[model samples]
Target chain A: MDYKINVEGQTARIKLGGRLTFSHHREYRDVLNQLMSHKAQIYEFDLSGVDFIDSAGLGMLLIAKQHAEASSAEVVLKKPAEEVQRMLKVAKFEKMFNIIQ
Target chain B: MGVLANDVQLEKNQGLDSIKVKGLHNNIFVNRESVEKSESDIKNSYILVVDDLEMNRKVLGKHLTKAGFDNIEFAENGEIALQKVAESNFDILLLDIMMPGIDGFEVCQRLRSQSCYKSLPILVQTALDGDDDRSQAFAAGATDVISKPINGPELIARLHIHLENKFLVNRLTQYHDRLADELEVVQQLQQDLVPNEEQIAAIQKNLSLRLSAHFQPSSEVGGDLWAAHELSDGRLSVFLCDLTGHGVVAAVNAFRLHVLIDTLEEYILDPGCFLTELNKRLVALLPVGTFATAFHAIIDPRTEKITYAAAATHTVQIMSAENMQINILEGDGVPLGILANETYETIQIPFPYGSSLLCYSDALVEVSDSQNRNISNQTVKEWFHEAKLKKVDVVEYILNALTSCGITWLADDLTIVSVSNETE
Candidate 1:
């Protein structure tokens, strides 16, 4: 997966493109870890550029959100790709995470 | 005339230093120290003495036993000699060509027919002094021809030659066996260096890379190497390298390149800067006159842009997405190990949804037909046209073309990697 991070003050926006499978988990975790160290209460994850995602990738996002919440940072999903949106709807993660279409 | 004590003393001193020997029809030298050590081992180095005359056998046996050889078995004729050879392992065979039952020629041929004694050294000790007798002995697979009465020095020299040859043969076989084992390990290491199938599939889905690869080493070890890793910024960096030589030396350099790439993956950010660091490391570490041709490119899937750089490599071609038109990417940089602190420039190419870029080693182009003719670029271009610009199976097609060109074996290591906009 390709990642582009735009950090504006305490809020950082992350954009993901491609498949977020096990191969990308390490790099994805690193991006989240970098975000968690900040004093921001909100972390924006943009998935519009993402083409496909598997269950493992969804689990990774949940973990990232949990970690962000512990640090008083809110992890929100914004502008998900068509496939990603369908996956989130199927998993019912849209209710737990603030998923923006 | 009476011999002086000084001459006797000189002979004794010479005997202490060296011994002239012949074995397997070849002259050999044996150091005195080694001869002493071999006495114990001689027990296992048995000999088969074949002669029609019992006296000849007895005298020869006594001579061998005096020389520290322990087991000397006798065969009265050629027929009996064949039987004895089949039954046991004998290091050397002493045969008389004029044997009664079966001539030495017949026995030697029979022994040679069997797989057991194909290389067993055969020395002919006979009273028949004709040139024809000597020729016949050789034709019968005789290792050496010694006319009686045999001098002790000649006998010892012939035996030493045969044993030395045996030791050398065994040593060479052992060396080759070890090389094969090491090749297996190197192959495993090469496999580990490549990104696994699952990883490639994952990256394909993300970057839409229309990537295909074919890696075949001509020998047990080769120099062609390639690696792909996702950068921290989500861009994928794919590198393909071919070291200067092939075999063990090339393999070592390829491994070193792997380590350099791993280190760069952890530390370096920009593709150009990464190559600079890699080149510096290679120049410092690799021996003079040795270098590598490398192509490193980073593809940002989100931006649909690629920053590509090459060092002493064939140009990377970008096929237009709309049509099959090709644009060659020419990156100017000296090959690794050629310059110090040399900065390399990368060309930013807009990789749209349906196009792909192809990077290949010189081996693909450096091919000659069966008549030893260079394969022209026009032929390659025609092949590209036939593939419909979709390089999903281009590797196989190119290899098949090269094979048809009469180039049965690749002279150098070959590597080809293509990243196209994934249509699937």
Candidate 2:
């Protein structure tokens, strides 16, 4: 998977692409680490470019949540494709993080 | 001989102290001891020198023997060379092209024809003959060719290179064979975890249901697991779980689930509670970012309901006899081992007679057709209709349909289950 991170003051924006499965954990961790080190108050993950998310990929999001919350930051998932949105809904992501669009 | 020892030491100096050779058939790994075993490796090599003249054989054999090769054989002609090679396990062949009757080129061709000598290094001796002879020697499967009035050092160097490669390949083949044997044993154990045909037959008979399933693990063992048990309440509870990885690790996780299921019987009656407790246990069992997606359901004839709870599994498909329209049961919850306190929600639907529920792993949907079109709910309903009309097992029917549509490969384990209440 490919991702671009942009930090602007209090908010950090991430544009992730391709498949976000366990195979992409290294790249995903890099992105998380890069953004988390900024200590932004909010983190927005734009997943419109992501096509698939396996069970392990979903766990990665939880890990991301834990990392962000540890630093008192909020995470928002934005514009996920229909299938990703459906999967997140099925996994009860609403209880854990805020999803938009 | 000392020059041959430097060959392995040089390769070691390149920072590859231990070679990790994988994908030499079934992801086998072999590490060659290039550093310490270099001296013994040269001494243990078997060399065959074939020449029409005894003078040439003696000279070549003496050169090889001086260069730490103690095991040497002689062949006066190509025919004897072929015979000796067939009888003995020669590591390398030193051949003379000037030999009469089945020359070195023909010997190379004949030996190359057999699978056993496929990798044997054939070093052909030429008279600095034209490019045609050298190319012909290569075309006939000569590994390397040396010039006549052979340089002793050059012959030893060529022999050392080929022998090193041959030994590495030998180690790889040995490791691959052992891995295949071990994987076969584990694969059988994995199959044992799945409910056998006799157990399934009895369960279907007891429920008066037509049940069918299709399970195919990938080349390596995967984490897909499933079981059906007759509960004490006279209800049939079925559960399927897929761990996140493949190979031996996934197989171990499947075994762990089997152990947990065998001990946790009380929660099996209630899908939600069962999954909640399973999640709690798995959270402690699995490592971070490693989790299992699961779907558990119980068929209750008394209440005429099929209640199920799921953890990030594919949407369960249900079709009734009335309209044959596919009903989608949304499977929603965090996967097991992700959170310690996550609780699955139990969803109940009518389990009238002649109704069938189709449950499958994500591979079914993830597998796109030739047009790259994903399987949708409508497409599934159509497939279900065709299977019902043809009176074929839905699991097999859909898999066949997918195969005919050019989906001949699966990257992950696949599982499909069809359970019908046929008590009408």
The top-ranked prediction according to TM-score is 2
Kindly give the stretch of ten consecutive residues in candidate 1 chain B with the minimal lDDT sum.
B3-12
Please, what are the lDDT tens digits per residue for candidate 1 over residues B1-424? Answer: 2222211111123535875443333444556665554544555678888888888888888888887777789999888888888788888888888877788888888888778677888988878899998888888888778888977656755665565566545555687899889889987787677776687778776655666666665565677888777665557788887776567777888888888787776434466777788888887887644567678888776678888777755446676677777766664456675456766666688887777677766556655688867664455656655565444466667777777776777655666676776546
| Cα lDDT of model 1 by residue, A30-90, tens digit | 8777766666777889999887664346656767777877888888999988867755664
Residue-level error in angstroms, candidate 1, position A1: 50
Stretches of model 2 off by over 4 angstroms after superposition: A5-14, A22-44, A62-76, B1-9, B14-16, B19-39
Reported per model, the fraction of native interface contacts reproduced equals 0.00, 0.62
- Per-residue lDDT over B55-119 for candidate 2, one digit per residue giving the tens place of the 0 to 100 score: 88888888888877889989999899999998998888988988789888899989889998888
Candidate 2 residue B262 Cα shift, in angstroms, is 1.5
Stretch of 10 with least lDDT, candidate 2 chain B: B20-29
lDDT for residue B46 in candidate 2, whole number 0-100: 81
